[model samples]
Structure formats: structure tokens, C-alpha cells
Target: MIIDLTTRKVKRVVKLPKTPFGITFDGESLICCCSGKDIQMISCTDFSCTNIPKTLMSQYSYIAIQGDKIVCTVPDDSKVSCLDNGKLVWEFKNESVLKKPGGITIDDKGNVFVVGMDSKNSLMISPDGKQYKQIQTKEYGLTEPSTIYFDKIRKQLLITNINSFAHLYDVSFY
Candidate 1:
């Protein structure tokens, strides 16, 4: 459903094939992590829907746009992947600390922020996808965090916990 924020009215309503969980815009279309085990692209101009074939996994939990690729978190496999042109371009190594990755976001520098659901923390990947750093320790009060958002303007990170209020961390120290 599209709403006109200026006039506060409903503009159009288009039904989707499945419930969208993680979504991102690639300038021209909206990419969604649909329940049908595929990435759905909704046209920004006409609201047309297209399902991209799933080639890497059975389900994708969260997604973020990283340059020309889409990085997605695979909860069931405890992995994260980058897809380009409906094909798996890269896959993060399945590490024990990455058990059940949920939320994901990428910064302008291509750094990846991913939620470690089982670890109750978040992992940061370098622009080259080589280095991994764990941030927001238990002492900082993170529990069952699911969603992550990066504020480029303020240089802060906002994370949502399933059972508690959202947490904000200043990333200016980085």
C-alpha cells in the first residue's frame, strides 16, 4: 500500500505474493526478502512485482544494499551472502559466532553490520569482507537483537532488541 504523506491519503494498494521481512531500494526497484524463498523486486515506477530465483539458500531473513550487490542474512544456515544479478557472488564464512544472523546493513564504505542472534551481539565486516569485529558486548546490554540501522549523518548505529528498547551506539570512535 502506498500512502501520500503530503496529503495524508492512500494512493495505491498492491498485494504482494508473500510477507516482506527485509527490504531495500536499489534506486529503481524495491528488493524484499519474501516468504516464498525468493527475492521480490517491486518496480518503483509502476509497482510491478518480479520474483528473483533463489540460488543460494532456502530462506533469507534480512537484507541490505551494498553497492551493486545485495547482502542477505541466512538464518537457518548461520551465514550471510552477497548476491548480484540473481546469483550468489559471495558468501560469508559460516562461523560459530554467527549463529542465526538476522538484521543487516551496509555503510557507504561497504562495511557490513550484521546481527548475531545467538551471540546476542553484532558483527562488523570490513569493506573487503575480510575482517570481522564483534561489537556491543553483553555488558553493554544487548539481548536478542534483530534489526540494525546505521546513521551515516550522525555516525551512530541503532539496534532493536526483541525484548527491550532499541539501543543506540556512537560509532564516531571508529
Candidate 2:
């Protein structure tokens, strides 16, 4: 559903072939992670869709795009994968660090931020998928964080748990 923020009214609704789990926009199209291991690119103007061939067996829970780079979180596999121009570039998996990773967002520098539903924490991973840091933990009141977003303009991180609580933080990269 497309809404008019100024009027708070629904403008239009575009239907899809499958249930959408995660979605991101890359200037022109809406890249969606759908059910049954499907990825689709839907035209923003016409709402027509083109399927992006599946690269992994696991179901994708969330996705984010930056230029030619596409990143997705696979909760069932407890992993996050990056694709460049539809080719697998890197996959990161560390059960101890990120268990059942969910909602994801990327920064301008290509750094990926994801939430671990099982681990009850949020982590920041390097662009190359080599290094990671647990930026938020259960002690920080993160109980089953489900979604995350990075505000590029304001340089803030927003994280939401499974319930009603939402946390916002001032984030900066050096």
C-alpha cells in the first residue's frame, strides 16, 4: 500500500505473486524477498515484477541494497549473504555472534547492521564480512530484536524488538 504521508491516506495498492518477507528499493525498483525462496524486482512505476533467481536454499527474512550490492538476512540459516550484480560475493555466519539474524540495513560505507533474534543482540559487520562487533546486547534491553534501520541523513540507528519497544541510537563510523 502506498500512502500519502501528508494526508495519511492510501494512494494505491500493488499486489504481488507471493508473500513478501523483506523488501528494499534501489532507486527504480522494489527488490523483495518473498516466500518459498524467491526474490523479485518490482517496477516502481508499473508495478510489474521480474524474478531474481534464488541463490540459497534458506528463506530470506530481510534485505537491504546499496548500489550494486544486495544483502539479505537468512534467519533459518543464521547467516547474512551479500550479492554483487546478482553474484554471490560473501556470506557471513557465526552462530555465537549472530543467531537467527533478522532485519538488516546497510550503511553508505557498506557496513551491515543486523539483529539476532535468538542471541538477543545487534551486531555490526564489516563490508568484507570478516570482522564483527556486538554493539547491543540483552543487557541493553534488547529482547528478541526483529528489525533495524540506519538513517543515513541523521546518522542514527533504529532497532525494534518483537514487541512494542523501539530503540534509537546516535551512530557514527570512524
RMSD of each: 2.1, 1.7
Candidate whose lDDT is highest = 2
lDDT of each: 0.80, 0.87
lDDT of 2 at 38: 60
lDDT for each residue of candidate 2 in 105-173, tens digit (9 for 90 to 100): 998788999999999999999999999999999999998799999998899999999886999999966
Task: Give the distance in Å from residue 35's predicted Cα in candidate 1 to where it truly belongs.
Answer: 2.2
Q: Model 1, residue 113: displacement in angstroms?
A: 0.2
TM-score of 2: 0.92
Q: Which 10-residue window in model 2 sums to the lowest lDDT?
A: 51-60
Where model 2 places Cα greater than 4 Å from the true spot, the runs are: 7-9, 56-60
Name the lDDT value of residue 35 in candidate 2.
66
Report how far off residue 25 is in candidate 2 (Å). Answer: 1.4
Task: Put down candidate 1 lDDT per residue, 1-174, tens digits, no spaces.
Answer: 767899999877867776778888778988888765677788879989888876333454888885577888888888888877778776786566678898999877788899888878898887666678888755677788889998877888999988988998888645
